[model samples]
Target: MGHAADRRPGTRVDRMMTVPAAVSRSDRASATREAILNAAERLFAEEGLFAVSNRRVSEAAGQGNNAAVGYHFGTKTDLVRAIAHRHNGPIERTRARMVAEVGETDDTRAWLACMVRPVTDHLADLGRPTWFARFSVQAMADPGYHRLMAEESLSSSSLRRALHGLQASTPHLTREVGEERREMFRHLVLNVCAVRERELAEGEPTRWPTWDDTATGLIDALYGLMTAPMTPIGTIRR
Candidate 1:
C-alpha cells in the first residue's frame, strides 16, 4: 500500500508543493534587492552620489531595516557598481548586435551610430522618468566614482570595437587629437542624455521629440565633429 501511494499522481503533487518554501524565500530576496537598487539609483541621481546615505536608500526602498543596502551590496561603492552592472549588460548586448550588423565598416557614421544608439535605445526602452542616464552622469562626474564608469565601459568589447572602427575611419587625426575627440564624444553623449532624461522627468519640453530623434541628431553632430578639419597650430592667434 505504501509503494502504491508513492506511485500515485497525488504523490507527485505533494512533492511539487514542497519546493515553494525555498523558492519563495529566494524570490523575496531578489525582489528586495531590485527595490533597493531602483531606490538607490533614483536617490543617487537626484541628490548626488555622496550626498545620499545607505540608510536613506534602505528607507526609500521600503525596507524596514536600515542596513538593507549594506546587507545586499556590502558597501556604497559596491551598490553603485551593482547598479552599473545591471544596466551595462543590456546596453552591451545591444551594442554587440549593432556592431555585428555593421561588421568591419570604414563608415565613421556607422561606427558612431553603433556607439550612440545602443545607449539611447536602451533609455527609450526603459520608458519615461528613467534614472540611469542621470545616474551615469553623476557617477562619471565624481572623481572617486569616475573610474567605475570607465571600467564598466572599457570592459565592453563591442565599445572597444566601435571606437577602433571610428578611429580607423578617420585616418587624418593624429593619435593625440583622436584621443581628445574621443573624450569629447564621451562627454557629449553623457551630458546630452542626462539633460534629456531630466527634461522628461520634470515634464519639460525636450529639444528632440523622441530618443531615436535624439540619437539621429547626436550621430550627425558626431560625424561632423569627427570629420571636421583641424586648425593648423602655427595659425593660432594665441
Candidate 2:
C-alpha cells in the first residue's frame, strides 16, 4: 500500500546482509542511517529539497553505497518524514510541559509563548550548529512536502490545545481569518528561527541574547499578529 511496500519485500538493496548475532553490525547500520539523515537534512536545508537526490545524500553521508538512502528509507518523502520524526518527539514533549504550566489561559501572549518556546527550546537543547530550523523552512517552502512536517510530528495534542487557546483569545476570528493568520504565523516562526539558526551556526551574533529570548520576541510578534484589528471598513454600498 505504501511506497516502500510497492517494492518487493526482500530486495537486495532493502535487506540487511549481516547475520543476526552480529550486534555490532546492527550498530553500524544504525550509525549509517543516522549519518544519512544528518546529511540529507543539511542538504535539504542548504540546497533545495528536490534539487538533491538520494545518491547525493548517500555521498554526503559518507555511505559507499549510493543506494544507502533508498535501502534505509525508501523515498524522498519518507526521508523527510524521518527527519521530522527526529525533531518532533522532543518538541512535543517540551510543548506539553509548557502547556501544563500555562493551562487554560485566555492571554494571546501565553498561547503564543506556548507555540514558540517548544521549538526554540528544542534547538537550544541541540546545542550549536543545528540544521532543523533551516531544513524546516525549506521543507515548508515546497507545497508537496510541506504537510509532512505536520503529519509526521507537529500535529500533537499539545499543538491543538495551544491553537485552541489562541483561538479562545480571539472569539470573533472567522475561519478564513484564522487560516490566513495561521499561514502568517507559520511563515514568521519558521523563517525567523531559520535565520537565527543560520546565524548561530555561522558564529554570528543574534538579535537576542539567547534562544529563550528569541522565543520571547516571537511570542510578542505572534500575539500582535493574532490580535491585530482586522478591518475592511464598512460594507460596500450599492
Candidate 3:
C-alpha cells in the first residue's frame, strides 16, 4: 500500500521520456564496437591474422561503415589489445581470489595452479566454440601484436602477485633460467589451449576431455620444468 502511494502516475512513461537521444546513440555505438571485436577475433583465429584486413572485419561485423574498427579502436594493435583486456577482466578477478587463497605457498604446483586454473575456468565458462586462446596464439606469433598482448598481460596485478609467489618458492632458480622457463611455461599453457580449441573447432578428438583435465596436465608439465635443474649454457660444444 505504501509502495503504491509513493509511485507517481505515468512514472514509467516519464522515465522513458527523460532518456536523451544521446543514450541510444551511445548504445548503438557500443554494440557496433562489440560486433567489430567479435568479428575480428573470429577472423584472426580462423583465417590466420595477417590474411584478414580491417575491411574484412567491418564486413563480417555487419558494419556498413568500413572505418568502424579504426573509429572505435584505433590501430590494429589497439584492437588486439582491447580484445585482450575484455577477456582478462574476469580471468584476473578469479585469479585474484585464487592467489589470496594460495598466499605464498612452498608448493610450486599451487602457484602454477593459481596462474593456470583461472584461465581454464574462464575458457570453460565461455563453453565450446571459443576463439580467444587461438587468437592469442596468433597475436603472440606477430611481433607487433605480441608486444601489445605482453604489455596488456603484464598489467594484471593479480598475475604479478601469483608470479611473485612462484618466484619466492624458487630460491635456486637463476634469473636467466627463470626467464627461459617462464617463456616455456607461457608457450605450453597458451599453445596447448590453442591446440585444444582447434581440436574442438575441427571436431577432432582431443586427448583431454575437459578444460580441468587440460589444466592439470599443464600444471604437471610446468611444475616439472620449473623445478628441473638448470643446465648452464656455456658455448655450444661444436
Best by TM-score: 1
- lDDT minimum window of 10 residues, candidate 1: 1-10
Alpha-carbon runs more than 4 Å astray in model 3: 1-20, 235-238
lDDT of 1 by residue, 1-238 (tens): 3443454445775667656866998999999999999999999999999999999999999999999999999999999999999998999999999999999789999999999999999999999889999999899999989998899898999999999999999999988889999999999999999999999999999999999999999999999899987776789656
Give lDDT per model, in order.
Answer: 0.93, 0.88, 0.88
TM for every model, in the order presented, reads 0.91, 0.87, 0.89
lDDT of 3 by residue, 10-43 (tens): 5875556546656888999999999999999999
TM-score, structure 1 vs. true: 0.91
Residue by residue across 2-71, what tens digits does model 2's lDDT show? 4653234466533544345367878888999999999999999999797999999999999999999999
Q: How do these models rank on lDDT, best leading?
A: 1, 3, 2
